[model samples]
Target: MRAIRSLSQGARTSLRQVLWGLVLVLALPTILVAAAGLYSGYRAEQQATDLRMQETARALSLLLDREIEKSVLALQVLAHSSSLARGDFEEFYDRAKTSGLEEPSWIALFEPSGRVIFNTRVPYGVKLPNSNRMDALQRVQETRKPYVSDLYVGSLTGQRLITIDAPVIIDERVAYILSLAITPDVFQGIIRDQRIADGWNAAVLDRSRRLVARSRSPERFVGQLASPNVQEALASAQEGLLQSVTLDGIPVRTYFSQSPTYGWSFVISIPETELAKSAQRSLFWLTVLGAVILGGILLAVLLSRAISKPVDQLVAAAQTLGRGGEVSDRASTRVLEFDTIKRALVEAAAGIRHHEREREEVLAHMAESEARLRLALNAGHLGSWEYTPATGALTTTPTCRAHFGRGADEPVTYADLIAQIHPDDRALQKESVALALAGRTDLQAEYRVIWPDGSEHWIRVSGRMRSGPDGHPSMVGVSQDITERRLAEDRQALLLHELNHRVKNTLATVQSIASLTRRSGDNTDPAAWNAFMDRLHGMAKTHDLLTATQWQGALLEDVLKNELEPYQDGIRQRIRLRGPRINLQPGAVLALGLAVHELATNAVKYGSLSAAEGKVHVMWAVTSGSGQPALLVEWVESGGPPVNKPERQGFGSKLIQRGLAQQLGGEIKLDFAPAGVRCVITFPISTMASDQSGAAETQQRYAS
Candidate 1:
């Protein structure tokens, strides 16, 4: 410690000695003034460089966003093209090749079952892999909607691409899937116009972290996971991020922006040295300025010392007088210039103190302003962030932390924010932010965030990117809780879906009832009419079962057993009934149950179940069909008075043949053999779905 103190003091003493010796000579003043001027000029130039760099980053982000949006638009156009939907492979292929569109681009169609109908990029007879459509086909077929898939390598073309799938619905059912593959070259072209400094690069990445295209290392880097910065940018998808990394052994600063249309991340990398080069120049000038200033002070001190030697002698005599040792009367007769020199020193000390006080006041005011600014930002729920396109350091505001469900005191950055966004939404959010940063659009999005607490919340964020003096973007935005709003909207959508379902069931019920009334015979035979009325009552009973359930659905077993209860007393011992545990749609349930009633009534009066020796058997089972499942049912009878085929079809025949067949999408077969009668019915599983309860009631009303 003593050595360090001694060295500092010694250095100070040496500096003073040197200054006292050099007077303000021509050489000292000239060098000092020139150095000071050079330093100021360097600072001005550095500021200009910063401004240019910031602009470049903003421009790059903008160009990337435009390219992505263009891709999305292209996909949409291709999806709606009638030729693409109609499987016009030859026309599509020819159009793609000759329409000035980029080559290797293709349009393809897939069936809801994942069968590829046609692909322009593939040979006319060649089959494309079914796996590519697996996920998309299921979602589109099941939900009947359009969806976008993440980037994948084309099994046919061997090129990395993203597929956009939209369902082709005909008669309210998905008929086919329209798909288009966007190649990486399209992304490459997007960044081609981006102006990157020498030794820098840019690229785009899909959600899987795969580099779809690159402006620099194009062919080599394709299919590789992007650098962490790119990953971060894709993850946030809403904000532009900057980071630094070593690429090909060269240290580079990278900026990442997102593409909303294509669900891609755009990354731009430049060398740190390029951005800091101006600062370095300024530093050099500052050094020179310091030297010159010191030199000027030294020169002035030396010149002053020479001129003040007489004043110093007079001060020495005054010190002697104060000590009671003064003798020379001439000491009081000091030169006028010497007296002026002493007065000037005293006034300069006072001025320096005054200046220090003023400087303190200015600093205090600045601190107060900063505090107020922070408070205002907090109140406004604004999150402020800064990214050095050259270094990748991202600093965010407290409000941003809260909005993202991070602790207010936790240190989070752009990369950290990106990591928190849901992967499905990250790419889109990043793209929007990039566009906003590029000044293409204002950044806005609703995204999901998984907080550290493991709870998820929806946030609606809106922000804008402003180009810094260095041309890089600084982002500022607000985030608010939209979780409740989104959930409510979802609930309303669900209720509407349920309502639509109920209305359809009701309509089917009305149709069945109308058909039954139309098929019933006119009131000419009193006995026949009386029997018809009894059948109608049975159908009415089924409708009651359905209406009680509000059309949600009903159990097939419950409806069937209820309709056959009256016949159980006399024929319970003579009957055997078997069927799967299943639910039924209202239309099918009512139709099937009432049709059963008609056959039972006919049997009790004239068929096998009519005699003491008669026996009746009923059975049902589920089986697979071309699409979902098929249900097969049989009713058999034996030991009746006599078995005979009906010469003419009656209401019973029509109900069993037409109503059951049409309503259940099933076949009804009746056989009159020497031993007894047998009836078989086969139908699709949809008929047995829980919503067909009203069908039974429809059939019952036919007797009325």
Candidate 2:
């Protein structure tokens, strides 16, 4: 076997070979058919040759009959002349010879008695023996009709001829018979004088089945039958006829026609083989063409197959490699670069399988690790948080359940966490988060959380943001319960405040005692001494209560009612306290306590609290300030004797102004009205705790 090249060539080669063999098989019949056709033509030509001769002979006979008609006319002209009465017959004879007639070999005139009266070449009054023997004349006289005779030898002229005759009447009765004869030589001139095609002949014949003219060989046989093959054709006088004939044993095809005037036939004939010769030549050329085409197809097939086989093999080998199936090692071929690519792909496919297996194992391990991490976070009550700064996904951990008061299985989100923040603290948390995201502040917020049960707790959440590789900050932080610790610290501070209050109160009591003792040694300044005791006594009363409350704080109304009770007829009924409940800080309690005591002391000496109708209506309460919950306390005294503004700022003024203003972060105002004295002190509510334990006791003692 030869080496194959490509698949396309192989297909083409195989197809061409098959096609070539088919062409040869098909051409075999065509060649045989052409040979048969040539042999059949030879036989047909032989038959045609005979038919042509018969047709030619019939055509000549028809021309001869027409000639006989013309002769009879010429003979009638001479025989009807009555020149034998007037003169000798030589005049008629001379006239007949000079008439310039063609084709007729003899002319004669017969008398009424059936004797030859005039002949073109006879002496006058010749008793022509053949005149009564002329079949043409005898027939015309007997029947009184012109007649055309068949080919016969004339008795007088002794020539083979066709005759024509007519009667010449002398006195309305049978008179004479005039006749002319046509020789075979006249028909020969007619046949030779006409033209015919190559391999064809022309002829004329009479109704007696004799050839009167022939253009070709056998001209000597005029007045004879055409041939044994076509004799029947002329005997029937059929015109427009074509038939095959044999002339001298040679076949021919003939065409014949009849002349109506004289009952003759004209014909033309040709050999059949000559007419069909081109068809045989064409068939031969077609056979040779079929052979050449078959050879070309065979050569094309072998060349095409050489190319197709290798291409088909290469395609199969490449497909095997692509599927990672086994193929020959030599499949790594030198055919083309693409074959090398197929081999490389096979190697890559194997490596890919190994990598794929390893990847699956790694993925499974990662999944396991994730599950464990999720379990630990849920168990530890730790909320896991991951902040992706890029996407802004802040995922909270499982521990955030406590913050949101949600079950572990319950779905929780950042919005739920934010909703749990106390409304008052919500803005601060929002601001902090916003600042952190904006890079202006760290993530730190202390805000109150409203638990699911409606109890509030303060949480301190602090985180340092971690920067990602892209330099954006992300927050991570923790929060825990700090509410109890904050409450404990508040309680401890309140106790310390009480201790400080008691110490300050003890010092004031000692100062008041010394002032009283010094005032007792001065009688020369009674007004001055009275004023001195009044101020000193106010200090002493304030300290006495401070020591009793352990200085947690005191109410303003309690401190006033207690010091003025000794001067009231109906203690509870005489004094009135009006204001919302207010708790004072330890320092405000001390200063306000001293200021009220001084005013009551002074009243017994010089103010309205000194008289019998000295009923003190004291009212203290909180009022609105610029900030919504700011505290204002008003001290109004009424139903007392007339009052005057003090002439000087004394120690009483100093205590209210200096001590309360400096320590309590508030202001004190003293007004001396005509009917009573009005004093007001206002401060912040934030300075006092919600539970006024110490202040409540002072109010109870004063109210009782």
Provide the overall lDDT of each model, using Cα atoms, as 2-decimal numbers. Answer: 0.67, 0.64
Score candidate 2 by lDDT. 0.64
Across residues 86-167, which tens digit of lDDT does each residue of candidate 2 receive? 4456776677667677745556667645676666656656665645455455567788867777777766556677666777
Give per-residue CA lDDT, model 1, range 1-704, as digits (tens): 45645765676444335545544455566666766666677667755654555555555556655654554556555555576556676675565444444444666667777777677666766776675558667987887655666667777667688666767665357777766677777767766755544567776666676777776768887887776655665676554445557445557656565555445555666677776776677677767666766777766677667646655676577557656786476656655555788899889999999999999999999999999988887676566655554557777666777878887789887677788898898988888876776664567888898888778888888776666677766665567777888999998998799779766765664455455545554433336556656766776787678778865556766775776666665536767665556677777766787778877888888887688787777776665535666666777888887777778666677766777766677788888876787887777765466543233222221000
Task: Give each model's clash number.
Answer: 40, 43
**lDDT (Cα) of model 1:** 0.67
Tell how far residue 353 is off in model 2, in angstroms. Answer: 66
RMSD to the hidden true structure, all candidates: 16.3, 65.0
Model 1 residue 204 CA deviation (Å) reads 3.6
